[model samples]
Target chain A: MIHALRISLAIIALSLLASCTPTTGTKIAVNQSEISKIKSIGVLVKKDEDFSVRLSREEMSNTGAAFGLIGVGIEAAVRRSSDKDKEEQIKPSLGNFDPQAPLTERLRFHLQEGAIATSEVTDGGEKTAADAILEVTVRQWGLRRCPGPAPEVVQAGFNVNGKLYRASGHATVWEREELYLNGDCRPWSMFRSEELANDILPRALDALATKLVYEILYP
Target chain B: MKRLIRHFIFALALGLVLSACVFSNANVNLAYKPVEGSKSPLSTVKPLKIALVVEDQRPIAERESIGNKRNGYGSVTAQVKSNSDVLTVFSDALKTELGNNGHTVVADKEPLYDVMLRVQLKRYWTDSVIHFWDVELVGTINSDFVLGKRDGDKPILSQPGQGTFRESRQFVTDSAYENVLNGALSEFVRNFSRDPNIIKALQQAGQTATPM
Candidate 1:
């Protein structure tokens, strides 16, 4: 009886292990009817602070165990210092590098391509006008040497939270937090660091916004 | 049950204390730092023109993340991964090391070459699992290497190398992990460099080699 019980438990354990599998992402949610109503969107970007490039989080290290909160406090400070080091490394590349103008331009271009009229709307939601509002908060965006599967490999990354709402009724039609790195992909070379910072990073982010808008408005 | 719960709590606290600087889901840059005192074998060997090919056979998930600080129930609290592709980094390192040993490492497969070596990574991973005030940082690499003539016939030599490192640590650091991973890779590749069979094969192949 005990042997049978053991065999039964082993089968159950094997079944549990075999059942573990990773699922791919679902197809983009397309509400065709809702998208049809969103003919025009006013892009509202919430940028209150300066866009500064920082190193990937793993670059920061607190190498030892913390004792009694004080150690934790010191390690935090050191880690912050390491975190801020990349901005200085890329200072030469940051010559007037701004993502705002280009991001809006790309949005307009994509939205128009999607056949939805698009315009820039300032913070005063009540004052300005478009059919709907596409408010985006760029949670994180910029270029850095990717925290690697290889070191000093340049990669541009972005995480954006977006919401599309009707201006008249303010009903949320679409909302999503989109974007992340899939692998330590090397899309650019080190010698082109300047081009990446000045041109590629901004362009990459513009496309990110454009893709989000593409998904929402194009169904 | 109470004692188990108490131990779990202690483990959680210790984990938090140890991983105070850990960045969850972060990629670590395993930059090229040569392993110290790793040159092995006292046998004299001839340097021959070599071709190197490295295949990474680790699962996609292992390629992405090798280690995690998981909750007792097995949810990841923190994760670590290599900042770059493993194949490229490992291949480049092996190539450089070969070059250092006076061997010309090349990409060409023409009859001009002597021996072509293929290194397949069977398993490569690292982890820092915390439990009951014990923090263990572990790095492992298992490799299968084969050496054959430029004729691409039967292989002259085939061997396996495994490198592992585990240490009780206060925490896992970027530098510490880098060193351990490098050590594991160095040790794995040393099988090719340090093995007498491989050495004798390379020398004999060199003597008969007709490089154009």
Candidate 2:
């Protein structure tokens, strides 16, 4: 009888385990109807903001001097400052911009391109066009620190916040932040910085496109 | 033998529970005009195609879960949902509102359509203490004109919203999801339909109506 009871319970348990299934279903995040309406109502990019070109007398005179003496150092710093200014131009005083790769591409809205120009005269004979002008007043733009730790774990003799420390007796240098001669920030190089900026500008444009679409369609 | 059997059962149950919670933090749902009325312009216009892209990296399942928790006034759970889902719902609600007002609606995959809508959900973060999801939704409309156009066409409309949703609510209570979606849609549609060019186009089409 004991053996029989054990077998019965085993069968019941097996069946229950087999029946277990993950929760699943099709949830339409955005249905067909909604997609259609937006497509029909085209979105326009906003006008680019007027950036006041600011330069110190020394910096202005150097036009070539900063690049000449510092090599790429001065250029990088100026670029960073200019980038900050450009970032502000894209932000809106109120509301928000969309942040998606695909949707942004579809709408062709971009920050670098600025908001859609609503005031531009269309070919149509109508005096006032566009149902409502979407004015995107940018508040914040640019690369902000993405928080969290490194994706991988690093260990050495002594564990110090994912860094490894070596004793004085060690012959070879340990690959660690404190042990490294240079800091986390890369040495300023114009060639490399320009390359990076090229990549970033397009991405910013992509993000801009996303933001522009959201403002127009949802405005 | 008894011990072995009990052990097996416990292990099985444990596995099932783990899988259930793997991506259990979200939900999604659609909200349109509760009933058709004068505001439904989409009923007259042919539906177009639009694609909604959610910004966050979460799987589609969690995104849907977040969307399902919305209400007319917008609920806390709805806000707790992901940013992408929130934008998805808002854009759809806006479209529905536009449709109700007599604009034709279509699918995003379809070509040769009148308008194309692209929406992006951005900056979605949740505050566990208060149980709220802070989000910004960005929307844009794209239109192409083959003739009499400048610079190869451009976007027709762009809009964005910064809104907040509470984390919890009574089972029967309405939340911010509904309120924001409804409000945003109303604003977008009213402005879209009132455009003089759009109105003129529609009027011209109406006048030229001959058996197609």
Candidate 3:
């Protein structure tokens, strides 16, 4: 009996010590009613002087800046396992950020698949057929703020703002400012803002679409 | 039987510990900051306020455990890593480099900044047959669309890199990714910085690039 008891206790201790702990969180989402509202609205794209309707390829090109950055480097950095991971473990987070891609691609990836007609066209001094042109005038594309890893949270926020207009008559229809927040899982795993942007951008775009739908249809 | 059981338990404990450590190392979190161009300094005609939107919709991990020639007879276990993480790796690198360059990175809502910089990855993938990873970035600058502004004036940059992940696998000690990342970000900063308007705007606003 005593031998069996010792073995059971040893097993329990090992079980407790051997387990791995992981961090968890959900992507931010908007209200269901808002989603339905955006889907209902249909605005025509203005072809003449319709810069706002199409996200210009030039305006879209700045997304490359995220690739060339380097510093203390990722070697010493520690990070936490992203919620996307199957088996989570903490490691150093990467802190660099790309200002362009998040707002355009993340938003387009989800919203483009929706009911509206979407296409990537090159404007060679001619107008094309489409409803309610979306002129995405990205005033700035990059990290608006970069806070280092800390006992304090390494908060990183990215901003995307521009206006949308009617493509046919070239009248301003909608304008918006988007802000995204993410970072600071733990003290040692500082500077995961770039990693955080992956989740944050998609979430922000979802929210922006919700707002856009409401403004276009309800307003 | 007793001796066999003892060995089994010891081996299990060791396996668990080693697996946890290996997994912990695999989860790499990266932040990308853009640095100023070494050859071409940044010139801005107007102050800029920028926002980044990343479309990170990666497919769920599809694990395939089948006998493959690479591992001889052992099962080749592969799971899909999120594409968002890959984007994050490059994005963080740009953020850091740009921060090192002397420019105020506006990541929040501010009216004073005049132009917006946007960065994005249209597609990224690794083809096992060719053993190559392809990365593409789309970058653009949106000036305050003053009425009747010409379309072609907008600053645009696109850079794509295809490199062998296997050649660098041996030397890759966490720092291997930097080479690829730097290649992508450098192209972006260089192209945009050459514009005289970008520099003029920076000087006019008295905006100094903040340090990381």
Per-model TM-score on C-alpha atoms: 0.45, 0.25, 0.26
lDDT of 1 by residue, B25-56 (tens): 65666644544433332124466777888888
Question: Distance from true position, residue A76, model 2, in Å?
Answer: 38
Docking class of 2: incorrect
Indicate which candidate wins on TM-score: 1
Model 3 residue B66 distance off true place after TM-score fit, in angstroms: 21
Compared to the true structure, candidate 3 yields what TM-score?
A: 0.26
Evaluate candidate 3 and give its CAPRI docking class based on DockQ. incorrect
C-alpha lDDT of all candidate models, in order:
0.60, 0.32, 0.32
- What local lDDT score does residue A186 receive in model 2, on the 0 to 100 scale? 21
What's the ranking of the predictions by DockQ, best on top? 3, 1, 2
DockQ for model 2 equals 0.02
Q: What are the candidates' individual DockQ scores?
A: 0.02, 0.02, 0.03
Quote the positional error of residue A73 for candidate 3 in Å. 38
Measured with C-alpha atoms, the lDDT of residue B29 in candidate 1 is 69
Tens-digit lDDT track for model 3 on A48-132? 2100111122122212222322211121121112211211221223233333334445334434544555443233212635444
Off by over 4 Å in 2: A1-219, B1-30, B34-36, B40-91, B108-111, B123-152, B156-212
Looking at model 2, residue B34 earns an lDDT score of 36
